[model samples]
Target: MSTISGAHIFAKKALLPDGWAENVAITVSDDGHISSMQRDTVPAGNSVGILLPAPANLHSHAFQRAMAGMSERRGQEAHDSFWTWREIMFRFLDVLTPEDIGSIAAFVQMEMLEAGYASIGEFHYLHHQPGGTPYANLAELSDRIIEAAEKTGIGLTLLPVLYQHGGCDRRPLAPGQVRFGNDPDRFAMLFELAAGTMSRLPEDAVLGVAPHSLRAVDEDGLTAAIALAGDRPLHMHLAEQVAEVEEVIAARGTRPVEWLLRNAPVSENWCLIHCTQMLPEETAALAKTGAVAGLCPITESSLGDGIFDGVRYTENDGKFGIGSDSNIRISLSEELRTLEYSQRLRDKCRASIATPEKSTGRVLFEKVALGGAQAIGRKAGALATGGFADLVALDEKAIDLEGREGDEILDAYIFAGDDRMITDVWSAGRHVVREGKHVKGDAIRAAYRKTVAALRMRL
Candidate 1:
């Protein structure tokens, strides 16, 4: 990605905070925030083309990007599902070194920028090395993540996860789970170290805390982690699978979402990832809590997780955002398209989950962008004064997008086209991607290839 010192951009048309605007001139300050705006103005000599506010990738486990196609083989487990997929993932991570994580994460972030995500909430949990022991720096892997963000120039909301036990019953961690396990005191130190490492990051960076999940954390651990987060965003996995939901119920005497609502303080500052198996009552109640549902439609579909009830969720005004959780495929269009298609498949309907006044595509994109920014705790989601200049420019020359404007353009771009339509991307005023490719695409791809090849040979 291209990193710019400062920029004055003029878009032929742009999606503004309120709605679309024509001949928009955006002034980006040296410190990387949008300082001023001028609409209906003549194009500057250095003006950019058709611009849209890029959405944030609110949830990701970057290491899994390497395992995208690796898990497609049919295994011995009959009726293979999310739990079976986890075994393969565990094996893959067993051999990953810190350097490999940094390279792989950089590649993933680079792909994200080209795919039209200007920011990422990295739900990073691969804390230690292959074994259960911590590295000398303690935050070695966390520092590697920061290095990847600095290398890629994408705005980062790093969520250092705390994984204590293996299950809701506080079972001892299995051998494969050792790397992610940490006691409350060590986790506190790691969290503080992660926060300290952020001082070297760009101004737009955020450091959030993730208490891996209800299965991995006890009441005391969750409480301690929450106190550490203060006002910053907190994230967790919730009811991603039926077995997990049942396990929570068996141990906690309630459904996973219901348990969180009853026992904890969940608000807009918290992002609950993958509410894939929630009941209708849980859906309606969770929506009213002002928390963001971090939906990973592509990954969820790939893993055979149950469909999220978008129809019920939207009717209750629930906030939601998309994530490339498994990173099997990183496509903004596919994620949003799959989200709608899942609802359609479940409801036996066409053009499902849309606002009365807006097309399905426009409504979904706007909702995700707003919710994603909120989830990542970034000053993004819109192109306006004081917002980070995280913008994506589409090539109007693409045939699918030709003669398209307004919501129709968004519809065509998302439904009819892929990332090839994206000509350039900017994150926090830095031009990191251009001509529909990351500026350092080749170098990052080379490093990722070496890492993946080595890991695959070991496996």
Candidate 2:
């Protein structure tokens, strides 16, 4: 037997960078990347159903996962905007310990693996304790997130976020915001500490930096963050709310995207999350900068955030990726489906994401996979020699997927099925999911239930 868990995978049909191929055989090396591949080859292992490259969830606050469904009820305010929802999030974080976060995050990653996401870019922001003191180990919470990823076998791009001020005016950190606050001097140390935690991660794991958002970081702090991040992947939230856009415009003399394009050395290394409120000019210009727009369609709808200008962005050939932000519902198919459906609703047209030749589902899958891989700075989103072995297998036996082939398989799954159609997943050469369930799903779910139950009582 091979010393490591190196192995082979065979698919009757698999989607490659160019297009779908038949009788594909993939060789997984001990280092967790494809060593070689052959088309129209004999089965190397059990011949599976249609195989597809999975996308990285490029923006996530893993700790917010625990509070997914608790905020749906109406609050005392007549209009519960993103601000009110943020208040609820603050209250929830005040009592959370690092151990609880680890368990919650493990569950979330397992769900993502089972749902056909090969990797995650965790935009982790909660750093200190409830009382605003750093742990003896500055990377204590970062270590917990890494532990969760290790347990769940999910590829992680760990982005340690630097959150300084409370708003555009550089106000003091609010009581609920202290845990997420840090100075430039301290943030540099935190970033290094977080990077150190990745030594134990699987191959293809990445370390990145996030400046939170303009509301949380002044220009000086943002510059400091960019300097520390260097050429690594840098992600930050953009205008997800009208109030936030207005605040940025009033404070910076321009909109959020406009300011960043003019001010920051924005490039492919940057990922701007939630461009939900941008002018058409802003959209097209930002697209030309090569920064990937990190979109969370489900969470955007759930939080009442406005729709993204995806039509304009795509028309301009903009790069974009999807995320399960807030983890309200982690479904790979749902994220892409919601994205296309939103455009259809807005434009009143079918196949809004499709080229005249390519099907909508095929285009959506390829675009997200490529864009997400770029945002995370990893070798994924394709099946070829030297590519990370990240793939999802759809159950051809599924009643909904019966008799489907090629693009129709993807179209049916994205529109008709959920995770139920995903029979297996391999991330970094490990078969983490089999038979539509994560290998560690039961144990992770048990721990997650226990943690959430105790947390509910406190709430």
Candidate 3:
């Protein structure tokens, strides 16, 4: 269904920036921003039980959703680490055509919408075909990603990634990594073409830049990427694994986080993904920089990556947001749950992220909502005038959330419930999910199933 211009949404209770409010009414302009908001108002237009500012999934590799459950078997290595799992990922992508990418991305975006994420910052790097052959159009894969966002009606932040080398030693791209390689000049052209394709999306769609990782992009390439990004969001993978830390230290005379902070102008515009292996000093320093820590808790656990020092970082006033990095799972509640649980498991403390004034769920939901918008460069993250209309509603009638008010509502919905309580989702005024289902859920699922079936046969 096409979104109605100047649509109105009323909520029985809403988690506003200041605090929870009751009987809230909001208006969305044709441009997809909240034109006005009023509290203590009568129910009008599309009414809901509970409302929240839905966060953007700040870091994602959308094509990886197809390979979710296929890599669980044990490998020859004594310990199946991120490196070993990556080999399987490389093999999986060799068979994915542009059509497969489009189908898989559409399904992933649809799932994100249903999971309560209103937008995505897709860190897209798969550029060439098998054997490292450039397609007729350089931005073919990016176009597929944009088309997927359009079909799902989810807000898009397409971060065209620049991946140059295979390791810190500046080695040639490996056979599996070749499809993601592009020299700085060629990557600039690819980024430009990708930006051109983004006009197919809504006005809220953003184009950002990512220097794939410290291992993949050299100092010069990273500088070029920062230049390309200008003032837009610039994301990078950093210090996700122990091996990666050792390699960066051996090559650059410093750890990943330390090296980047000393070398680059790290600021709020940059989002560093998976800083799961940081020293306390590095964590404190990074927090002071105002850069976003793009955490992917589920993927980190799946790959056996170490836990981030979230307590130390937050104490230093760090900004953080959650993402479905590997796309193995996309539940927003589980991401927050896994993050808080990891901290508790490490420190043997309860309510690791909760403050004296706020419960665990309230703190996590509010922090992620604001930080995610900052990381993706979206004007959202609050039920206030001038923010994008990215909203999620929960079922008050659900047993988990029944009779809950204020912070108690968030506490129960997150700790005692899951995305099942997400009854409706609006992405930039586009009401994509209603009654816990995507408007095009069936079609997206059918396409994904066919693609995965053919993919399995090929494997």
Give the alpha-carbon lDDT of every model: 0.90, 0.90, 0.94
Candidate 2 residue-wise lDDT, 110-219, digit = tens? 98999999999999999999989999999899999999988998999999999999899899999999999999999899888887889878668899999999999999
How do all models score by TM-score? 0.98, 0.98, 0.99
- Report the C-alpha displacement of residue 81, candidate 3, in angstroms: 0.5
- Candidate 3 Cα misplacement greater than 4 A, ranges: none
lDDT string, candidate 3, 1-459, tens digits: 345698999999999988999999999999899999999999999999999999999999999999989899999988888999999999989999999999999999999999999999999999999999999999999999999988999999999999999899999999999999999999999998998899777889999999999999999999999999999999999999999999999999999999999999999999999999999999999999999999999999999999989889999999999999999999999999999999999999999989999998999999899999999999999888998999999999999899998999988988899999999999989999999999999999999999999998998
In model 3, pairs of residues that clash are none
Candidates in order: C-alpha RMSD to true structure: 1.2, 1.5, 0.8
Clash count for candidate 3 is 0
CA lDDT for candidate 3: 0.94
Error of 2 at 129 (Å): 0.4
Residues 407-451, candidate 1, lDDT per residue (tens digit)?
888899888999989998889888888788898899999999999
Q: Against the correct fold, how does model 1 do in TM-score?
A: 0.98
- Candidate 3 residue 132 C-alpha distance from true site, Å: 0.5
> Which 10-residue span in candidate 1 carries the lowest summed lDDT?
1-10
Q: Which pairs of residues clash in candidate 1, taking residues 3 or more apart in a chain or in different chains?
A: 1-432, 1-439, 2-431, 2-432
